[model samples]
Target chain A: MKTVSPFLELESGPRVKVILDDVALSLPQGANLAAALLAAGVPVFRDTPISGAPRGPFCMMGACFDCLIEIEGTTRQACMIEVTDGLEITRIHHDEALA
Target chain B: MTRSDLAIIGAGPAGMAAAAQAAELGLCVTVLDEQPRAGGQIYRDVDRVAPLRGDILGAEYTYGATLTASLKHSAITHLAGAIVWAIEDQFRISYTRDGRGAQLDADHVLLATGALERPMPLPGWTLPGVMTAGAGQILLKQSGVLARDAVLVGSGPLLYLIAAQMVRAGTPPKAMIETQTRSDFISAAQHMGGALRGWRYLAKGLKMLASITRAGVPRYTSATDIAVQGTDKAEAVSFISNGHTQRITCDTVFLHHGVVPNVQAARSLGIAHTWDAAQQCFVPKRDEWGQSDKEGVFIAGDSAGIGGAKAAEYAGTLAALQIAFAAERLTREDRDRCAAKLRAKLAHEQAARPFLDAAYPPYAQALLPDDSTVICRCEEITAGDIRGYAKLGCIGPNQTKAFGRAGMGPCQGRYCGLSVTALLADARGQTPDETGYYRIRPPLKPVTLSELAGMEVTTPDAVH
Candidate 1:
């Protein structure tokens, strides 16, 4: 997959490593987790339970809840969560019942 | 428990201005916002993003820097990362910050939640890679990322603004599919005199359109029946333009129509709202000073109506002045003298709204999507399901919600409320107002039960 980083990354920002579905990836420490994942070519953040359809962040400003995932055993909006080192995130499975 | 003379929800232009003014008037102010920064959506991450991104975000965005800085220096208690979930009677607010529940009581509360992009529910809108234009702009603003090979769809000034912003960032979209027709321009022309009073806005719009054209993005005007085509991701967009079928392959599709007041907090608080025919959305009823029907509550900024940032700032100032007068901190004469200039500026700022509303009405076809198109992305409900409920004598959105669970998702009808109302109205052959909207209840945003249980309750008088 090709990376689609649209803007130039500032050199001085803090860099951190986080685990995405057991894959370790480094991103800017304070960047939006969803944007970081998308820049790293991780589309299809979660699948709709009813239709098993793929959905990603839509409104990005917390209005749309499409970019939901399991983070530290709790479902959180990926767009709303900031990237932090050692953060553990798991892609929400379509068949997994929402809490 | 905490107490204040005024509690302002949201840290946008309106809330920031209101808090600053109220604090200067000898009132204790507390401002709560969900975002990690003070600037609301319009100026999200301005304190951090502006210096690094600079010209890419443009001057209008950098203006938020001064507002955020002033807010930081003010006497107001600013709570970033605070999610206000409930506001009880007697001005009690329950919110969570840093995963701990807290409560605050205020003599008055100001709602400045601001606006959201009008729901555009065309076929395949729920697919991955299909997103609102505002979402794309947020990505650029917050994380310095943009969708690659994106095709812009729908109509309104925001469409052009995002397109121009992308061009400035050196990642111009593949093309634009506009839904407004020649008649819309003609309708807007009648309001030219009033619009000219806000000449700066008109000039800004012209400059953005010129930038889009100069970028050489292919534009299809009067586009209708627009739909994104994909199996699991957005692959292409199909539409009818100029009496001909058109299809464009793209990696991403961004849609926009206009914006409507984020009335969730207001509606949950039982604030009276009336439909604004020009803007074609429900707005909270407020007086000149931003007082709602519910005493001790105020609605300001675009949340009261769809005025832009400048109008929101002026409205915030006016509302604070009124709160000051109510607190007996200023004489009536002094309040009037302070509000005179703000009132004049607000009038000029809002003069162009009617023209903009007429020029970029939500695409009618987009509102009433085809039967197979999904209306509620959260519940996976389709247009056909809503229409079926309507045909079965569903009286309004609330009834439809009961029957089909269309608005009972995690998004809490924020994404589907307007479309559901319009679809029901079209089916019932009644006006949207007559069809009515979802009866919003609180816990306006999701809250953990643990957080709620942790809240400390205090008597109103005891806190004061």
Candidate 2:
């Protein structure tokens, strides 16, 4: 089936490249960073402490901030912020805020 | 240092009408709309490519377009693509333009900021193909693209309209799976009786539904999300009914629970808010005049509540009249008559809301998406992490910050705020509104860091 989605990886190429936790990886060009990471087999975005229910990006727009990742040492909107080559994203942890 | 006697925050029905009213009363006004053009969501541009030939936009939108156009000749200053970032008690607003920050001070502030798509999270909702109904409509109407061969899911009056639009655009959805049930609609109809106060509105809903039926959109009521399946993209959907599983293969899925006020600026302003249980959202309490508790702050449009564009226009006109009367430009009798007419229209609009609300009950899906469901997709946090942080006795969002770092990652809590609030609300047995969404500060859209750096930064005036 032919599909066209604004958030999909059409051609297999390094659409955008970003550094996750300082590790470099190339994502499908123009794909959402979260979706790209998921496609790349990076399952977790952040962790919860109590019941341990895993949550990810639900609303892809900036409306549902479940997809907050630190980029260039500042928290940025992952969906709104397009992926750029060498962009650095640091995963936030449940206990990280205490720091 | 742009200046106006009254500054309206949006150019939708509310803001445009209010600006026209105020200008007619001899006050200088400025209307700021974020869209490259005017017309809020309801009167959104239909297919920027096909560009609804002025005649095709129907009377309301075309009339609104004319009204907005007429304001251009008034003393009203219209700023397109200007996103107001913050409001001060003295009626000054900070905003960004052409990658620079500027400030505008007005004697009176009217926030017609409008509404936002309500976030409804479910399993596989993070998939690439899933999107809000509004997003799909925007893509179709503005981009001339359709989410065809798509699964239209959710419970709202908008869903059918979306399907109708898609059909009208020559690409209807593969199926319409509604989370609302017939029994739920029975109550919705009983609620509609209250709305029957006016014949026009009753006819409107009928016309919309008739259009939907004519479109031949297949519908499934009492439906709920079971799962969205795909490896990297959504290739299929599996929903359940009466403990039975059903599956459909579709590349597109549109979801919307409802809409909530885009209250970031309002919350940042620290206005007292009351929970409208029927509406299931926190809205600023306003007088019959649309004035917030703040003396000079007025709210109109969906920012006040969701009563569609007509109500917004009426509210906007009344708000402007209030300001006009307050400024002593209008006689007492004129003000009273306008207010009376507006009040009656408001009462009629308010009547239809209960029916709409009952028709769309927020479906409670098992949100805790296993231990692997990513909670903070940006930070890569899992549901496990959120629960772990909550176990540390993080009672509220602020407290959770210290324990699990839930709301601190970025997007400044816009993306994860709703789900986190829903999770915490469920945990505490509180309603979703009690958990409260995040604070909306201005530059509603993302502003480049340079914009903030260049801001005059007037000592970061107290939010209040």
Please tell me which predicted candidate would have the highest TM-score against the true structure.
Answer: 1
- lDDT per residue as tens, model 1, B182-274: 999999999998889988899999999999899998999999989899997888999999999999998788999998999999999898888
lDDT of candidate 2 over B198-220, digit per residue (tens): 56666766776776678787677
Candidate 1 pairs with clashing backbones? none
Please report, as a residue range, the 10-residue window in candidate 2 chain B with the lowest summed lDDT: B46-55
lDDT of 2: 0.68
Which regions of candidate 1 fall more than 4 Å away from where they truly are?
A1-12, B453-464
- Which candidate gets the maximum DockQ versus the true structure? 1
Top candidate, metric lDDT: 1
RMSD in Å for all candidates: 2.0, 6.9
Q: Model 1 clash tally?
A: 0
